[model samples]
Target chain A: MLYHPLVIFFIEQGVPVQTVLLLLMLPVVATLVAFFRQVVGIKAFGIYTPSLITFALLAFDPNGLKYGITIFVSVILVGMVTRFILNRFRLLYLPRVAITLSIVSLTILLILVTGGMYQRTGLASVSIFPLLIMITLAEKFVATQIEKGSRAAFILAAETLVISIVGYFLVSWQTLTVLILEYPWIILFTFVINFSLGKWTGLRITEYFRFRKIARHL
Target chain B: MFEFFKKSQGFLGMNSRNLEYIRPNNRKRGMEIADSKLLCKRILKKNNLGVSTLIAKIKNYEELDQFDFSTLPDSFALKPNRGFGGEGIIVVYARKKLARNTTDENKNNVWIKANGSTITAEDLKSHIRNIIDGSFSLSSVPDIAFFEERLKLLKLFKPYSYKGIPDIRIIIFNRVPVMAMLRLPTRASDGKANLQQGAIGVGIDLATGTTTTAILGKGHLIEYIPGTRLALSGIKIPYWKNILRMSIDAQSVSHLGFLGADIAIDRDRGPVILELNARPGLSIQLANSSGLKERLKRISGLKIKTTERGMRVGMNLFGGEIEEEIEEISGKRVIGSVEKIKLIGKDGREIEVEAKIDTGADSTSIDIELAKQLGFGDALKTFEEKVGGRDVLTELSKEEREKLFSSIPDLADTVPIKSSHGYSYRPIVLTTLIIDSIPIPAKVSCIDRSHLSYPVIIGRKHLRKFLIDINK
Candidate 1:
C-alpha cells in the first residue's frame, strides 16, 4: 500500500509505530466525544478537553486510573476555590485567569513534591501534559461555574470525566490499538461517521428522557 | 396492539429526520435565512406576507448608545436576530404608567411581562446587551437586537393560552403541509410557546382545522387544558384553511422543501408568520400521535403544480375522518345496546324511546304503530293505499312496485326488512332524533315492530358517527 511508505519513513525517523498510531487515534476519540454530545445528548466541557484528557490518561500509563482521577479532581477543586475567591475581588478577566493558572500550577507542584516525599512514583512521575490539560479543564470548569452556576458546572464536569474515562478505556484496549496501528486508513472512517452524525437532527437519547412526557403519549 | 402500532408508526427518530428531511430539503443559504430573525422578517415582508412589524433594531454598541427607549411603543417584543429556539426573546406585555414622584435616575420605566411580572428598563437594557453579545445565538456569535410589535391574543385562544400568545407550527414537506401542532404556553414554560420549554402541543386536524388529542411537555396525553375542565380538543381553530395556505405559500417562497412555519394569530390580523425553521423538530409527530415518515412518504414524489394544489392535496390526503376525529376529540363513547333517544314527530311532538342498537341492520326502523302515535298516521295511510298495504307490497311486480312507489310523493325512501315471521317492504321518512343529546336528521323506515321489545332500532347507517360497543 502507498500508505506503507509513509509509515516506514516515520519509523526510520526514530518515532515508534505505536506513537504515530496513537496520534492518529486522536480524531477517533474526538469524534466519540462529539457523538456523546450530539447524539447521546451528554453535555460536557466541550470536545477538546475530554479528548485531550483521554489521550493524556492513555499515554501516561496503561493503568494510570488512580493518578488520572487524583489529578482531575484536584484541578477542579483548586480551580473552583481560586475562582470563588477571585470572584470577590472583581479583577479584570485576563489578570484573574492568569493568577488562577499560576495558583493551579503551584497546587500541582505541591502535590508532586508531597508524592515524591512519600515515594509514590505514580503520582510523582505523572507527565506535565496531563497536568496542563487538567489545568485547562479547571479554567473551563470555573468559568462554567461562574456563568451557569455550580449545579450546571458540576453536571458538566461529571459528564466530562465520564466521557474522558470512556475514551481512555477505548484507547487503552490493546487489540483496538494494534488494529488501528496496522490499518491507519481506519482513522479516515471517523470522518464518515462524523459526517453521518452531522446530518442527525433528531432527538438526542437524552432528549428522550427530557421529553419522556411526550414519549409517554405515544 | 396500540403499543405496537405506536412503536412502528408514530415516532420519527433523529437519524431518519436529518437524513430524510433536513439534509435533502433545507439548503445552507435557506437555513441561514431562517436562522436570522431579521432576514426571515425581510423575506416574509417582501413576499407581502403578514408578519409582526419591526419597531426598531440595534445592530451595534453605537446604535445601542444612540437608541431612545421613549420612542418605543407601550408593548413590544425584544429579541436577538440570531437567537435559536425560544431563547434571547423577551416579550413585554405592557409598560407601567409613570408616576409624578419618580426622580431622573429612576426615570427609566418598568415593563410588564405576559405573566404579569415586572421588569425595569435597566433589566431590559441588560437583556438586549446580552442578545447583542451573542449569548443566545447558536454559536455565541455577535447578534442584532430588535423590537417587534407584540401580537394580541385571539379571543378563541384566550382561555387556552396562559400569558403568552399561542402559535401554530405547520410542518410542510414538498410544498404539502404534512402535519401541524398548536403550541400553547404553560406556566411551566414561562409563557413561551416552545415545546422543549414545557409548553403544551395539541394535534390539529388538517382538513377541518380543529384540535384533537393533545400532549403536554415531553409526551403526556392530556384531555383538557391544565387546571381546567375545558377539554383541549374540539377547538375549531379560526381561519384554519388560510393558515394552511399561508404555510404552504411560505414554504414555496422560501424554497425550503421541508419547513416549519411558526405562525401566530393576532386578535385582529388573524395569522402572521412569526418565523421559519429549516430544521423543524420531530416532536410534532408525537403531538399528532402520527408518524412523519408515513405522511412524508405519502407525498414524497407527487407533482404539486401550485401552492393551492399542494394545500388541496394535503387537505384531501391528510385530512382526518371528521366523525372519528370528533369522537376521539370529544372523548365521547359511541352508543351501545340501548340509548334514550328522543323522536320528534311530524306535528313537532316529542317522545323519548329506548332504541335498540343493531349494526346488522342497514337503516333505522320504527314500529308502524309508534310512527302513527308520533303523528305520521296520515302519511302511513297514504303509503298503504299506494303500496296496497305492507302484506301486498312484497308481492307487487316491478312495474307495480315502481308505480306504487312513485305515486307516494311523501315516501322518502324504501327498504326491505326480512324477519323470522315474514319479509316486508317499508316506506322511509325523514325524521329528527336526539341521540346522546346530539340532534341528527335520520332516515326512518316504518315497519311493524309490534313483536320486537324496542319500538325503534338504530341501524349501522345511522351509527356511522358512533362506535357500537356491545358491552355498553
Candidate 2:
C-alpha cells in the first residue's frame, strides 16, 4: 500500500509519527464519546471533558493502563477530601477551586516521590501534561459538586471515568493506530458518523430508564 | 429495528431537540436577547407586556461603590443580568429591623433572604462584585447586576410554594404553545423556581389550566404538596388565559421560533413575564408524563399567524388528552362504572353492597329496602306514611309539602328531583359511604332502586374525589 502523501510530507518534515497518529486518532476518540452520550446515554460532564480525559490517560504510559487509572483515582480522592474540608470555611468559589487544585498538586507530588522510592519509574516519571490534565478534571468535579450536590457530582465523575477508560482502550489499540497510519483517510469517516449521530432523534438508553413509566402508557 | 423504535418511542431527545427544533427555529439574535435577562425584560415591557419592575442596577465596581443600601426597598431580588439556570439570584424577603441602642452601622443594612439567611452590606457588595466579574453568567463574561422588585406571592399559591413565587413555564413551538409546566420553589431549591435545583414541576393542561401531574427534584413523580394532604393536581391556575396570551406575545416579540416563557403571578399585578428561555429543559416531559416529540411534530409545519390562533391550535391539539391521563397520574384511585361500596349502618354496623357510579345524577340514591336495613327504616316509613308515593308527593302544594316534610323523622329530609318521568319528591337520609377504602359522609336519597341491578347508585356529589374509568 502507498503511504499517504501528507503522512510522507509530515515524516520528511521531521514530525514525530506518534504525534501525527494521535492527531488523527483524536476524532475517533471524540466519535466514541458522542456514541456513549447520544446512544448509550452516558452524561460525563460534557463531550470535550471525557475525550480530553481519555487522551490524558493514553498519554500517561500507553502500555501501562493500570498506572494511569491509579493516578486518576488518587486525583479524585484528593479533590473530594479537599472539598469536604474546605466546605466548612465558607470560602468564595474561585479561591475554593484554587485551594482544591493546590492540595491535589501536593498529593500527586507525594505519589510520585513514593513511586520513585519504590523504583516504579513509570509512575514516578509520568508526563507532567497528562498529570496536569487529570488534576484539572478535579475542577469540573468540584463545580458539579457545588452546583448539584456531591451525589450528582460523584455520578457524573464516575461516568466520565468510565467513558474515558473505554475511549483509552479504543485509541491505544496497536492495530488501529497501524491502520490509521497506512490509510489516514479513514479519519474522515468519523465526520460522517458524527453527522448521522447528530441527526439521531431516538431516546437515549438512559431516557428509557428515566421515562420508563411514562413510555409504557404512551 | 422494532426494538430501536420502542427505545425512542415518541420522547424528544436532546440531540433531536437541538438539530430539528432549536437550530432551525431559534435565530441567533433572538437567542442573544433571551440570554440577557435585562434586555429580555426591557423588550417585553416595550411591547406593553407585564414584567417585574427593575429597582436598580450596578454596572461595575464604580456603580457598586456608589449605590446606597438604605435607599433600597425592603424586599428585592438581586440577579446577574446574563445568568443561566437561575444561578446568582438573591431574593431578599425583607430588611432586618435595627434594635435600639445598637450602633453597628453595617448591621443596619442587613437583609434577610428567602431562606432566612442574613447578608450584611459588605457581603452584598462582594456578591454584586462577583456578578460584575461574571461569576454566574452563561459564558463567564462580565454582566450587569440589577435589583428587581420582589413579587408578592398570590394567596392561592401561598401553601404550594416555599419562600419564593412560583412561575409557570410554557414551551412554545411554531408560535403554538406546545407544553406547559408550573415550577414551584421548595426549601431544597432555595426558593428559586428552577427545576434542576430541586423545585417541583407540575404539568398544566392547556385547555383547562389545571395541573395534572407533578414531579419533584430531578424526576420523581409526586402527588401531594410534600408535607400536606393537598393534592398538587386539580389546582386551577388563575389568570391562565392572560398567562398564555402574554407568554405567546413574549415568544412572538422574541423572534425565537422555539421558546420557553416563564410567567409568575403577582398578588396584585396578575400575570407578569419572569423571563424567557431559548433552550428549555426536557424535564417537563416527565412532569406531563408524555413525550413532547409527537406534539411538536404534529404542529411542526402548521402556519399559525396570530397569537390567538396559535393558542387555539395548541389547546385543540393537546387539550383533551390530559382529561384521561389526569386520572392515572392524579394519585387518586380509579373506579369503574360499577364498584363495591361499604355502607356504615346505625351504631357503626357496616354492610358491603355493589353500587353504580353514576356521573349523570346529582344526588346518590339507594333502595328503600337497603335504607331500612341500615336502621333508617323508621325515617323512611314515617316519610312514606306522610307524603305517600311519587304520584301523591307531586300533587301536594308547596305549603302542604313543607308541612309534611317537618312531620317526618329528624334523621331524614326531602329533596325535589327532576327525573325522566317528571318532577318528584324523594326522602333523603344521611349515611357514610366507604369506596376504595376511603370513608365519605353522604346525603343519599331513598328511592325504589330495587329493579336496578345495584342496590346503591353513587352520584356526582360524592364522586369528586374519585376518577371514573368506564372501560374498566
Candidate 3:
C-alpha cells in the first residue's frame, strides 16, 4: 500500500502513528457532523461539540463509551443543579454561567476520583482537553435551558449524544482509518462535500417527515 | 422511480444551482449591494426606480439615542439594513386614536398592526435597538435600522393580504423574467410576507399575468385562502406588464445576472421596486409546480437587446398558455373543459348545447335523442342500413366492410364505440358547430347519452382544430 508522505514522515519521526492518524481524522469527523446537521436534519448541539465529544470518546481504550457517558451525565447534572440553585439568587447572566462552569469542573474532578476508587483507570487518565470540552458543553446546555425551556435543552442534549455516538463509531472504524491514511488526498473530497452541504437549499429529510401530507398528494 | 424522474426533470438541485447560476452570475459587489437594504434603496432611487421612500436611518447606538420618534409618520416600517429573509421588519399599519383633550406633549401615540395588535413607543424603540444590534442580520453583524414609508394596501390585494402589503417576487435570469410568485401575508406569518414564516406563495402565469396555483408554507398546494372560500387561482394581477418591465430593469441596473426583484403595488404609486435578492430561494418552483431548469435552458442563448425585448421574449417563451401556444402554431382556438357549442341541424335550425370536451374519446358523439331533435333521424336510418348493427359489422369480411363503406355515400361516417355494457355502432352526420363565434364543419357520431351530464361530447378527433384548457 502506498502510504501518504506525511504519514511516513510522522512514523520516521517516532511520533505515535495512531495520534497522527487521529489528527488527520478530525476534519472527516467534523464534516460528518455537518452532514448530520445540514442534510440529514438532526438538530444536534452545534457541529464542533459533537465532533469533539466523538474525538474524546475514540481517544480512550475499549471502555470509551462507558467513560464518555459517565462524563456527559455528570457534567449535565452538575450544571443544571448549579443553574437551579443560582436562579433563586437572581444573579446576572455572566456570573451565573461562570459559576456553572466551575461546578461542572468540580463534578468532573469528583468523577475522576470516584472512578479511581472503583479501579477504572480510563477515567483517571482522561485528558484535560476532553474535560474542557465537557465543561463547554455544560455551559451551552445551561444556556439553552435558560433561553429555551428544560424540554428543549434535554432534546438537544439527546440529539448531541446520538450524533456523537455516530461520529465515534465512524472514527473508530479500522478500514476507514487505513484508507484515509493511505489516500490522504481523500481529505479534499471531504472539503468538497462540506462546500456542497453549505450550498444545499433543498428540503431536508426531516422536513419530508414534517410535510408528509404534502408528499402524499405528490 | 416516478418520484426520482419528477425530481430529476423539474427540480433544480442546490449544487447545480450555485455552480451554474448564482456563484457565476452574482458578483461580490452586486451581492453586497443587494444585501444592504438601505444601500439598495439608494441605488434604486438614484436610477429613477420607484422604491419606498426612506424617512430616517439610525446608523449607530449614538444616533439611535438622539433620534426623535415623533418626527416619523403615523404609518411606517422599520427594518434592519442588512437583514436577510424578511427578519427585523416591524410595520406599523396605523396610529391609535388619542383623547380629545390630549396635548402634543402628552400625546404618546400607540401604533397598531392590521391584526389590531398595538405597540407602544417603548416597545418600538426596543425593537429598533435589536435591529441596530444586528440580531436579525446575516451572521449577526451590526446593522443600521431605518424607517421607510409603509405602502397602503392596494384595493385588489386588500382581501388577499392579511395586514401587510403583498409583494410579487420575479426571478430574472439573463435579463429575462424566468419565474414569478406573489407572496401574500397571512395571519400565521404575523402579517409578514415571508414564505418561511408561513406566507402564501401563488404562482403567476408569465404570459397572461394571472395566478395559476398557490402553495402554503412550503410546497403544500392550497386551492383556497385559509378560512375563506376565495379561490387562489385566476386572479388577474394589476400592472403585470409594468411589473415585468420593472423586474428586468432592476436586474439590468443591479448588474446581477441572476436576481429576484420584489415589487409591491402601492395604492397610488402603482408598482414599486421593493428590493433585489441575489440569492433568491427555490420555493417558487413548488409554487409553480414546474422546474426552473427547463425554462432556464430555453432562454439560455437568446440574444436579448433591451429590457422591453427581454420582457417580450420571456412572455413569448415561458408563458403559461401551453394550449394557446399550441393553438397559435396550428391555427386553432383553445377551448376549456366545458364550452357552449351551437349545433346547426339539417333543417338549418340552430340550438346551443353545453358540450364536455373529452380528449379520451376518439370521435365526437351526440345524443341520439338530440340528433332526432336536430332533424337527423333519416341520416341515422341510412347509417343503420349501411353499417348494420355492431355484431353485423364485426361479422363482415374486410372487402365487405370496404364495399359497405363505399355504398354509404349519403351517411357521414360510422364508428363502433365501446362502453361498459357492450360495443355499439353510432351513426355519424355532418353538422356545423358554432364555437367561440367561429362556424366550422364537424362529423359527430350519434350515441344515446341520456345518462350523461352533457348532451354532446366533443371528442379528440373533432377537437383537432381546438386546444383544451383544463383550468378554463
Indicate which candidate wins on DockQ. 2
The candidates' DockQ values read: 0.28, 0.31, 0.08
Q: Encode model 2's per-residue lDDT on A1-218: one tens digit a residue.
A: 34678898898899888788889989998999899999888989898888888888887764446877887788788878888898776666789889989988898899888988998778767678888888898898888776666878888988998999999888888788778888899999999999988888777888777887667646
Error of 1 at A119 (Å): 7.4
Tell me model 3's lDDT, rounded to 2 decimals: 0.80
Task: Tell me the spans in candidate 2 whose CA falls farther than 4 Å from its real position.
Answer: A1-13, A45-47, A83-98, A139-153, B1-4, B101-105, B325-472
Please give the lDDT score at residue B450 for candidate 2.
78
Across B403-436, the per-residue lDDT of candidate 1 in tens digits comes to 8777775577777656554666778887888888
Q: What lDDT score is found at residue B121 in candidate 2?
A: 81
TM per candidate comes to 0.70, 0.76, 0.67
Best by lDDT: 2
Kindly give the stretch of ten consecutive residues in candidate 3 chain B with the minimal lDDT sum: B4-13
TM-score of chain B of 1: 0.70
lDDT of 3 by residue, A123-142 (tens): 78866887787789987787
Worst 10 residues of 1 chain B by lDDT: B1-10
The window of 10 residues in a row where model 2 chain B has the poorest summed lDDT is B385-394
- Pull out the clashing pairs in model 2: none
- Candidate 1 residue lDDT tens string, A34-146: 89987898979888888888977775684567778888888888877887898666554457768888888898889888988898767766667777887888778766764
DockQ of 2: 0.31
